[model samples]
Target: MRILLAAALLLTSAPVLAQQSPAKTMTASQDAFLRDYAETRRFMSGRPVNPRITPDEKTVLFLRGQPRAPIQTLFAFDVATGEAKEVLTPEAILKGSEETLTSEEKARRERMRVSARGFTSYQLSEDGERILVPLSGKLYLVERVSGKSTELKTGPGVIDPRFSADGQQVAYVRDNDVFRLEVASNKEHRVTTGGTPAKTHGLAEFVAQEEMSRFSGWWWSPDAKFIAYTESDTGQVEKLSIIDVMHPEKGAEDYSYPRPGKNNAKVRLGITPVTGGKTVWVQWDAEKYPYLATVMWPKKGPLTVLVQNRTQTEEKLLAVDTASGKTKELLTEKDDAWLELEQTFPVWLEDGSGFLWYTERNGGPEVELRNADGSLARSLVKPEAGFRNLARYIEKDRTLYFVGGPNPTESYLWRVKDGGAPEQVRPGTTGEAVEGGSVARSGNLAVISHSSPTSMPRTYVVRGDGSRVGELPSVAVEPGFVPVVEYREVGPLKFHSSLVRPRNAKPGQKLPTIVEVYAGPTVTVVHKSMAAHLLSQWMADQGFLIARFDGRGTPMRGAKWQRAVHLDFSGVTLEDQAAAVQALAAVVPEVDLQRVGIEGWSFGGYMGALAALKRPDVFKAAVAGAPVVDWLDYDTHYTERYLGLPQQHPEAYEKSSLLTYARDTSKPISPLLLIHGTADDNVYFFHTLKLSDALFRAGKYHELLPLSGLTHMVPDPLVTQRQHEWVMNHFKRHLAK
Candidate 1:
């Protein structure tokens, strides 16, 4: 649950600066600092994203770009030829005109946090003959031979264009309607025409895209005979206006935003023919199971739809009949806390007899292969490490490739054969044929990008037996500095922590400390990857000892650890951070407890501000960026999932807000700096204003830095640098005793 505000320069991997056209606003000193502190060049280089191995396993396709040259270029890595060729560039796609995108397109891109231009994503045809790419609200077909693109003359606002199973037809959304085009004849047909200003087809609703991780409203059936798509009516959702005060001429953006306990988008599933015909409505108890989580259509089996209730505590996996639009419940999972959603799941076996499901049914999360009738076949993974994510399900080999590590700080690859117990594929390092250590597999050939805390990440092409074929050429330039990190679990609560000390510090030298934390339920702060803590490394270079912890509320440990803070965000998260500090001080021996500071964004921001106001004895100074002062202001799915209905759980709502403790003059309100962007739609700027009002009423002096036209994820590098400098100075003023 990273709020969009952290989008700018996320890690060393996703660098924000463009090398082809670097921003000239950076000062020479700032440039030098960027080089010496953490080296932004490593981010720009070696960023090979969306690596998909070709079906023939002879080559791999990936998107690459750099700072100054942020517009991505599609490239192919020859498995045997050992040649890397540029497929197409954003310049080639745009030709000469500047990009003109629709509001709908822009919203979807923002939801994905798409940073680069050209081919950010693409879909290979089932036959592996061609690729389909949607760019600038239009569709393009890329030829495998010459890499030349042929723009499909589809109507405007074409998005999520995907090829049908056999690659004869393509389906996409235009305006709000779903449309399909024949590749050979360029014949286009409208699948649905009932989309109105309040109702839409083919495009995912707000909550589905933002929270549920289901980006599209449409799913194509196996035979390409019928298409299943969601129709959403946003008429009931409340509209919130987000205006660009930086440039008043641009006016305000009226967005349909659903806050907690409010009406979410009304969605229904329907099926239509590829040649365009009457729609068959899929019947379900919509009121009971309203949240559509995901849609998976097996190559030869029934369509699977995952749905959840408004509270998100229970989820249902249903198998739908394409012809009659009838669905039967395949499985149901219930949790006291909200059920976790995976980006990839409901893996159907190649033969279509059973499907693999990720669950916590027996003590912890694991992969369970179940029959079509919902009977368990076998458990694919041991719960000790806990199931993380599915990497590649090699149907031909009947092997399930996935990732999970014993500890949250590290993740490793694993595989299981025919519903058997899983085993580590390539252990002894971080990074896998998965994300963080991204892996791409095709025909038993996999290209993996991996790294560790002390090592620079690299790319490797390996075979099914885990033997390396060769190394993929990486354009990455290694950073000048190697981080000195100590990964540990602190406190009786067993909080996962990463500590970085100043390079020249002596063993017993006491130093002012900054506890950087994002101790939220949604994401972890400490990870095994080197890219995870580059910011902390840079802060450590500034002469302050930096420590971070993933305490009770964070995920990946187990449901119990995560559910500990179910309705009590304030008590569990902040207490764990404080406890970690105390425990670390006892173990490390040089922690300057008297001059400790806290800094974080979003949920962590709330923690920092709350600490300064209520627990100032421990946190001497704080930096709160885009803090959520009141839980009531957040969107429905995310807020209610943890806090429950605010009306029913009034005490929980009251107990969690920073405003509840704003007037607590317990410790003279330690130095606090509140930073935010006025145009942030996710957390909203009003949160900070509400906190400021409360603090001002309490006669607490604080600093506020308002960015005019930025969103939660500050995409602009200059603003990011300024914000970083602001936090450093604030810490220096109060914590450097």
Candidate 2:
């Protein structure tokens, strides 16, 4: 039965992914497989992303595609009336015009992995009366009440357009220069003149966007008088060329890419007014701390910015004086490992009396409500060391909402009222055993999305009093198959692990197991949402036991656990995966540890490749997709934060790199399949070529699959589905012993 089920899945799957793009002449079964897989992903993840409730809580603004349509449209959901209506659509706005994106815009979306066509993002005004949507270099402002939109006509190649608090003016960056457009006059005013070929007035550099999550470089003052933006100069940054082999006529595009140990883009902060005035440069020691992590201008405090050193070990929350442009340190946070940067809301209290900051300076990760002058008043939660965060505060109940827990696998929604004890709102949020979903509150209503491994996602509208109003109407299609999976902590380390057996498995049967892992910092293997692990479930349905474990170095556990990979990414991460397999096999007896294999992409890909080379006794066969064979080949921001300066610590760099271990012939070799996209600029397809070269030199024969015109994160739904299916077939071929 197991063999037959695997054969059925492989009928539409490729035994070996063709080097060329998937042909259009696929069989009916293959076409149907791709379509079903794509639809499942599109629907299971839910259509709406970045949902925002208006300040009044009367309506919710979100972006979703129209009824499984390719193009996404802006929508507004009326809470009182319980009606969802489309505000704007791509067809209505484009009006048959060709959609052409500037290179900068394309890079931004690529970093975000945003595939939705039309307005992928929007900025809600402070008053919640307007939203600024930038589509294909053009700006459109939509009124909430009237559902009317008018083109701002800011300028060519406009990006990062934001609205002032009063909604009377808009500050936008166009072609590296800052420009302000007054709503009433419909006139554009240039705010800065110093931007040059290598410098930008208001834009995040590549590192900031890709690693820091600081998407926009501009911020508006609460009084709607001044705008604070970053000045990025990339003259010192190194450049890398990316050429599309498919279109040689277009030639290579050279972009400023700062690799490990290379000079990063010089950054500075400047303040400009809406009415147009001289730019006030914020004074800070840029040489000591080049990375600007976060910028905040809360309603109740001075402009605060968080800056970090190149190694990311230390950070300072500085308060900048608007008049002199000089900064004073509010607090400093230092860690033996790299400091983390998070996007937090309501930096200040309601009256702006004090500020709320989340950091590890207090011995563990927790939120702190400081006094007006930056002195710690008290810790929001007790001295428990676990993952917790400040989401937002409910004014009516005086409750500060947060998400996290001591268990790394699971996180709960908790709230604290006026420094009282913390209350758990959603107890069962861990990916292991899901009961409820994550919650986000706006106004008097909270938007709740719930799901489990065996169920579809359901988003509900809940009142402030904890009563469900109704389900938010979603047009997403349901999945073709339901998932059957279970969670366990089989090791003494209490490893948060999961095992997805074949949905149609017999009562007592042994099965070949494939361990799917990420096992790196800031990435979790277990999530409460069923849709999050859909691919793993699909792999399980194909007659192999799919396993995932949030091993050491992953987030949500505490400072100690997350920092275990401080300088050694190859050791703890791999050992935990191997141990978990043994532990799970001990518990379930039917899990065949001898026939075990490992597979993953990116960091997980690196892990899979390492297991195949270093631990062949454990992982017999591996699928390494877009693996980073060397840490030195990655960007400076992400790599340096972990391994430090490659020049200063050459030995550490050598030990951390997978190429070093590949040369060791005595480690034993296993069957390995290397997969990568030619156009993957992030991991750089060069890593795969180098690894393949190392394997060949070591006299190890391995399979290689190269994808054309594919970035690190392939955006096409059809391509993603087929690519995953092909990988499943590869595992079946080798692991189906």
Candidate 3:
């Protein structure tokens, strides 16, 4: 009777045990790493560390411990005296009866809970006595010493407020027009008011900001005499319509957005006096060159503006005399593909002899000391063991900091004297060194260390002599957080990856796996930072082994790693990711090869589609969001740089495109889900539409999720949540036994 009852129980529970048998338990070391990893995540989210040195160089401000709820208040560590103070308390910002606030006020307060979220533009005064904060689309002056704050202006779309050199007056932009405000008298005057519906007087359009990374459109002269601004006429550019559903009436909003080989906004440099009135347009012969790269005011001289030709192969650093309106070419850089310009203005030496310039003329990216007249003083730092790109320059201390890489996955911090041999500052460290802004006064170097994976960022202070002073107070790991089990332990996964196993995993159990990928060149997933990556963490918690790997073409490694994608955008990167996945599967027996899933957004979406098409056997399911299925469909500047001219490398472009493999996608592929915004300008909705048509013709069954009236980035939180939910659902449906 007992044997018969046991047989009945085994028969009843066989399916449930089989389902639970695949989850593999982590090892002791892995378990410890998981605990530490969890602690690292908690510590990072709770206590953020950033190196902040005073302008006098007498003190370094470091934050310790996490603030409660709103995250506005925390302990600030003063490096000099080793004293900590609580500053910027949440209680100061919160209204009376925080729970009883209006919905709008509550939303605003909640927005402040996330650091660096609410403000569109923020700047500290020269003396750090006051903070110029952009709130509710206007500028406000908040005293650091006293908790008092005053509204600076209430105008039409204000941004980029800058205090004059004397800190007496503030210059900012209002609806593309430049405005100057007196701090004490509260007097405001319109400096340049010619910005009409078609023409912008002192500010650039959306495309310039999104593509060129030019956020602020103006700069103030060191003498506080003139304001240099860019007036972009976007009427000539292509108009893209975006729908606004939040309005009482859902309607289309039209804006000019330039795509590749399309007409771009004609931008011109203009200088205006602080006293107010008209702006003098910086004269440039239209036949010679038209595009402006950057504008800067160096020392008390004329405004220096960097201009590039339409082809983007040649760049000229032209100094425009504000008084005379005469322009002279200070320096010209030419390249085979496209000349790279420094995003920030050139650092001027105190002596005014010249400035530090970064160029890639000698095979690889290097730094050269250019005289005030733009003659090369010397090549400060050149590539030695590997390709080096000057990321930042500390002019006061005569130190040049850069990221050099033997390969794309690994990067190291390197420094060299203004005219000395390059040396690895941090040796044998596998992580990338993120340069904090140069301390203007002390000439001390501040950096944040990051690794490919399994390493969190830690701030450090280094002297100009290549000696480490000490690590600044960093995020403390929480006691209960576990790393190994909660995070992926994939070795040297190309470009770094973090894996997470289920909490209930047992020894030798095989588990289905999912990979979250973003193959964009601009962003790196494996950086050594404490970011709340919700998708991967959520998937791991849901009993699926999840992984994230940054393929080649990701940033922070240096020139070669980024430039390698040139002319072969998706091919080489996809190959590296596939190899990494296979390597991970081989090492981790619990990764069930038959039930693997891959997903990404934008460029990542492009990669996901390619992965499923190229290696159907490896990736069982794929969720691609707003993917650029074809290189021809993407914008010109970005696509042409990486994939070269479509006319030049037709075969390479075709091979890299997922559309080319549509006919060959007859394998027993896992379920594929394609999502896109209907009005996506960056990666057009047409990309998904064309792919869907092709897939249908190929007799493939795939899910298509279209977000109506959405742009390139779906800003609606509900839509974003739904997208994540769809991805999770796809993974659960395919990867689950």
Candidate 4:
């Protein structure tokens, strides 16, 4: 299952440096390294991303931008010759004009957590002849051979545009309705209508996009004869307003946000002909399984849909008959906790024999080859392999590829032929590393993006046998210094732990420590890559030590380790972190228990607040950024999965809330600082206000820094640089004694 909670902002993607206009004083405290870190987007800018290998595997197309910038332009890399050149640029299309976005486009980007501009995403047609690029509320089609970008004239407000399987038609959502365009004639056809704010068609609901990571609500059938889409009604869901308090005159924007146990959006799926006809509504047990998690229309099988219960413990995969809109139950999965939705599954064989499924039904994650009737054929991958996710399937040799490793700190590429024992796909060349690599394959070619303890991430093109072909070069500026890090498995839990120390640290010198944490689900902070600890190293160079831990509830462990956070988000997460730190102090003499501070963002933010309020004896100070102060206020899908309904599990909600700890004044509180963006929509600004209000009423002293006109992600370089400066200063004032 793919669950997404925000990690430390500095560790994730940041916006380009050119987007924000900062005040003069913002850069006054930034050293050359800090400035470079922010400006280069944590050294992510100028790196190749979103690679699409053509069907023939003769060329690879990708998007790249300027150094320290986020405006991506399309480029084509020749596979045989290893030569790359620019194909399309926003400047060429706009004639040096700035890109303007409609409100719909802006909201879509925000929900997807996309911070880049100018071709942030693109879709390549199956035929490999055409590319679809959506920008500034319009659609542009670029020819791969001619390098010509032609505006489709689909008018304005176009979103989620994609090519049909045959590449003869284009389907997109505009103003909540679906529109079909004939690629050859430029003819437009309306597929669905009667869309309004109360009920929208061909668009994903807020929870699906923000939480489930399913951005598009419409999919084309394999033959391109029909389009399956979702119709969502939020009329019964509660509406919450997010106001830009910095400018009250601009008014507030209201959204249908479903809280715990609240009425969620009523969603239904339907099929409409591309030639235009009445919709055929697909039928299912809506009351029993309300969440439409995924839909797939593979070429060799019936149309399949995955649906989940409101509580998320049970889910069913159903097969559909398009002509009659009838459904047949294919499989049912139940979990005591909650079942995670796999990001990739049901990979059908070419002859419609069976499909590959990833599941934890066997107590741990494994890959099972299921028959066409959804019965188990055999287990392809076992628990001992640490099967993380399926990478690709090579039909030519009947070989299956996946990403996994025995250790959580590293990921390796594993390939098996025809359900045989999996074997590591090691580098065929000497001194080449594939550890911590993710695979993207096309025919006999594969692109491995990887990094190790000694280097930042880089991408390489290789043949099927893992022989290096060439490198997908990166223009990222090197962070002038190497991170001095030590890795260990600490405590009885064997938590993955790492410590970043100053380069000049001497023996027996105890230093003030900062714990950069993201002890939550769906993310693991400590990795085998040096790039993972770059920010920690920078913070350590400021005369302090930085520590990180991936404890229970974080991913890459077995189900038992992850489900421990179930029903106890606050206690379990904080307990593991506090214990890990205490255990580390015992083994590492340089760590001073009395001089420790904690900081995190999102779930990590919640952990930080929990530590500051309840475990002040361990943490001297804390910083919580974009935290969920109360579980009751979070979205339905993510919250209910762990804590169940707030009404039924009131004790769980209270025990897991920072406000519950804030209300208790019997114990001394640690120095606490809360940071949030005023315009944040995911973890709304109200979360911080709620906690501060509770603290004020209880006479607890704290600090709050409200970032004006920003969202959950502080994308601006100047602002990020200043934010870190403030964080370092906070730790210095409290932990440095």
Candidate 3 or 1, higher TM-score:
1
**TM-score of candidate 4 versus the correct structure, residues matched by position:** 0.94
If scored against the real structure, what TM-score would every candidate get?
A: 0.93, 0.92, 0.77, 0.94
Order of candidate numbers by TM-score, starting with the best? 4, 1, 2, 3
Question: Candidate 1 residues 395-418, lDDT tens each?
Answer: 666677777766777766677786
- The top-ranked prediction according to TM-score is 4
- Per-residue lDDT of candidate 2, residues 42-152 (tens digit): 464346656777788777777776544557678788888888888888777789997778878878888887766787889898788888888878988888778788998
| Model 4 lDDT tens row, 612-716 | 999999999999889999988989999999999888888889899888888887876787878888778789889998988888777777777777777888778
lDDT on C-alpha atoms for all candidate structures: 0.78, 0.76, 0.62, 0.83
- RMSD of model 2 against the true structure: 4.9
Which model is ahead, 1 or 4, in terms of TM-score? 4
How many clashes show up per model?
18, 0, 14, 2
Top of the candidates by lDDT: 4
Give the poorly placed runs of model 2, Cα more than 4 Å off. Answer: 1-34, 39-42, 66-68, 383-389, 395-397, 426-443
Q: Judged by lDDT against the true structure, how good is candidate 3?
A: 0.62
- Name every residue pair that clashes in candidate 2: none
Candidate 2, after superposition: displacement of residue 463 in Å? 1.2
Model 1 per-residue lDDT at 127: 64
lDDT of 3 by residue, 73-165 (tens): 333345555555655433344334231222222222222322222332345667767666554455677675674767775464555678887
